[model samples]
Target: MLNIQNTKLFWASCLALLVTSLSFGIRAGIMNQLGIDFQLSTSQLGTITAAAFWGFPLAIVVGGFVVDMIGMKRLLVMAFIFHLAGIVLTIFAQGYWSLFLSTLLIGIANGTVEAACNPLVAALYPENKTTRLNHFHLWFPGGIVIGTLLVTLFVQLGLGWKVQVAMMIIPTLIYGYLFSKLDFPVTERVSSGYSSSDMYKAVLSPLFIFMFICMFGTAITELFTGQWIGLLLKNVTDNAILLLTLTTGIMVIGRGFAEPVVHRLAPQGVLLLSAIFAAAGLYMLSTFTGNSIFFAAIIFGIGVCYFWPTMIGFVAENVPKSGALGLNLMGGAGMFAVSIYTMFMGNFYDNLIVKHLPAGASLSVYLKAPENSASAQALANAKNLAGPEILQATLIIPIILIVAFGGLVIYLRSRKKSRSVAL
Candidate 1:
């Protein structure tokens, strides 16, 4: 039976996460508008977006280290303040610096949510750490679906991007209220009587380090692509936002029912399979277009469905001594890598478009040309040509993960065999 107090805390954590992902989805939806309104280039927009990612690691890593000292409640309260400030600042943002600063604040809030809630959930349901964490994380994609659908609805109703962004405030306030009224518990590491020194030692272990490195691959494969999907697929489909919605929608359902898969494959086995599908799906997305892209999206969604939570779960189960610090560090590393990659991706995408443009035609010149004119057509062709190549470029990350996870699975099985033989 579920304990009433823990259940309430769990749902509040979910609501907090919902707020975090809603920001992501809304930002993805508004990227084009921000570019147009601010006279910003894709690279500039990516920098603003990258702020959210890079800032996340800063707060999460710091919160992880200090959460035990300051308490989860305090961290969450900080999240509430940051969320409100970030949202209001973003709604009023003027240009690059303002947008970057606001996004950085929101990213910090997002990280704070994870820093407190991940360990909270793990502590709340110690017996089912992996499965429960998957359930907890389902909200990441779930909130994206909500945010994207809201963006679609608001856009259709002739509402501006500012209005769409303001929608997040409703949930943010509710989560704040929910969190304030709750009584919090100590983290599992503390409850289990482990020392902070033990956590530090465990995080530096070879196994933990290996997983930390793998986090970069898994996170980039999942988040970077998700964030950029609208731009990447815009040339190929008018309903690009729907594709993001569809992809995350699949993730929602898959994660909701993740227990069976986790039980059957084990975490490492599941990761190996996820990496395989992610690589294949990403490559397929690069190659496919039009209605056929939906098929590719399904495969891609399935591949990344278990990645974030499962990676955390693996560390929690396998590296218990590392505690909240380990979980937060894993998440921090992933976001930090994505931060750097987002900038590179934006720059690479711009370069690709420039490479594909006709001789004597610059992107700015073509962009300002009359719609349906020869110059506009040239720009369209460039986007179409350049987009797929970018997706293909990202294919290498998942491919590397396939080998890494496969080795991990084999090594783990060998260790199990050795123990059984000795017994």
Candidate 2:
């Protein structure tokens, strides 16, 4: 125990993240309705969904650089402003473009939460950096779980998804009140006397550069593949919907065990192990058959469970000089991965259709073809052929991560031995 008295602030940060998660779920639940109302295609709706992710890099990078200067309190206040405005805008959105802009604002607000509070948690619990960060991140998937239930409940009760979206305001306001009343401490970077230029330089440092590449691979492996779980497993098992839920559940429970793991293995050790499991699990997902599908999915779930938070923990722990900027860049890399790879995979899928399937193949995929549906049928066949390969391609990402993280572990061990000899 670090004798932490500011637990209220930590809980408030969780609340803020909870609100963000709720917005994410609510929007996803309502996408079909929004599409109907706007007469937008699924691809267009995907663009709306992407805005929530793509906006993260900009807000986090800028906020990370300035967060120490303004302090967590003001940075949180900025997040609150954007969150409030974005939520309100989303509620009143009339069409595709408006929804896009509103969600973009929400994405920025979401990134602000990560930028401000990750450092706050780090500064608050110096000895428990990995453990506390893991605990703090539980709210992300935890919030998603709760938000999904809220969306389902509201929809079941014949309430529109807006009602679920509106409910997030309660948590948002609660966090706002808690944060407004409290005083924030200085960031780890500031207390350590790292100047702005010093922090910026830390990001470009060779060690940080390696960590950046590792984070990029980690993000793509975990999230990029995750986005396509349903389509990838559509034919493998009938539990496609439950598959995502299962993965998220495993993540929440896995993080609960992070403290013990961090104590034993340390951050690099944990990442090295995580990469191994992730690589093995993705292989299982790409090739596993029979009753082993569930088994493989579980393995995959546990594999990625520790990745995102641990990566952040590693950067904050080892690259302390980079401060909030370091964590910011790390998170930025992940979000960028999600944004870019979604497009990349979509392109790959389309190319697969062009390469393998015939025109008008998708519309009559399983049923009789309506007139002028040859192109749609072609798309369906392409998805069938391409989706699995996209998933299998993700195995390459984790394989890269294994090598990168393995090297980091060796380097860390060498440095530790050298420090011991000097001592």
Per-model TM against the reference: 0.98, 0.87
User: Over all chains combined, what TM-score does candidate 1 have?
Assistant: 0.98
Backbone clashes in model 1, listed as residue pairs: none
Worst 10 residues of 2 by lDDT: 362-371
Per-residue accuracy of model 1 over 1-423 as CA lDDT, tens digit each:
349999999999999999999999999999988987887877898899999998799999999999989889999999999999999999999889999999999999999999999999999999889999999999999999999999999999999999998999999999999989989989989999999999999999999999999999999999999999998888898998888899899999999998999999999999999999999889888999779999999999999999999999999999999999999999999999999999999999988988999776677777567778988788888988888899999999999999999999999999999999999
User: Which candidate has the highest TM-score of all?
Assistant: 1
Q: Residue-wise lDDT of candidate 2 within 276-351, one digit each (tens)?
A: 8888888887777667867777888788888889989988888788998899899998887777777666556555
* Candidates' RMSD to native: 1.2, 3.5
Candidate 1 deviation (Cα RMSD): 1.2
Inter-residue clash pairs, candidate 2: 360-374, 360-375, 361-377, 361-378, 362-376, 362-377, 362-378, 363-376, 363-377
